[model samples]
Target: MYAIVNIAGQQFKIEQGQEIFVHRLDGEEGAAVEFDQVLLVDQDGKVNVGTPVVEGAKVNGKILAHVRGDKVKVFKKKRRKGYQKETGHRQDLSKILIEKITF
Candidate 1:
């Protein structure tokens, strides 16, 4: 079975044994986390949706590792103003392995 869940202000469709990268979480490797904001679930072609979230529905996941995304370069220039700016950024991320989804 699979379900749509909310994680770090984002929605994701996930299934058991699946791995996904989400916004950074305050957990160490091998730590466990629970996502209680399950929006919908599909099993055997049957779909269950909630008003906001499904009551008594949850998704269990294990923290695999903490990671960083590739650097992004931002450059700005104003022609004839002799002004230029450059910046770079990298987003912190976390890897989680879905263990189960129960409703």
Candidate 2:
């Protein structure tokens, strides 16, 4: 079975045993998390979609580790005025393993 769920303001299609990276979440590594914002689910070609979220539907996962995304560099330069600026950023993230989905 596969499901579409909301995590950290983003939507993702997930399945059992699948690992995915999402915006950082609270709790420590090996922590168990449950997401109830399941938008849709498909089991053997039969689909169930919720208006906003499926009541009583949930996705269970385990927090494997906390990670950071690659740094993004931002640079700005102005003409002969000789004005330049540069910045870099990395997004905090979490790696999770989907354990199960239930409705």
Q: Which candidate should be chosen as best, given TM-score against the real structure?
A: 1
- Per-residue C-alpha lDDT of model 1 across residues 49-99, encoded as one tens digit per residue: 989998999999999999999999999999999999999999999999999
Q: Can you give the TM-score per candidate against the true fold?
A: 0.96, 0.95
- Predictions in order: lDDT: 0.96, 0.97
Model 2 poorest 10 in a row by lDDT? 47-56
For candidate 2, the lDDT comes to 0.97
Ten consecutive residues with minimal summed lDDT in candidate 1? Answer: 42-51
Candidate 2 TM-score to native: 0.95
Candidate 1: residue 84 lDDT (0-100): 100
Q: How many backbone clashes does candidate 2 have?
A: 0
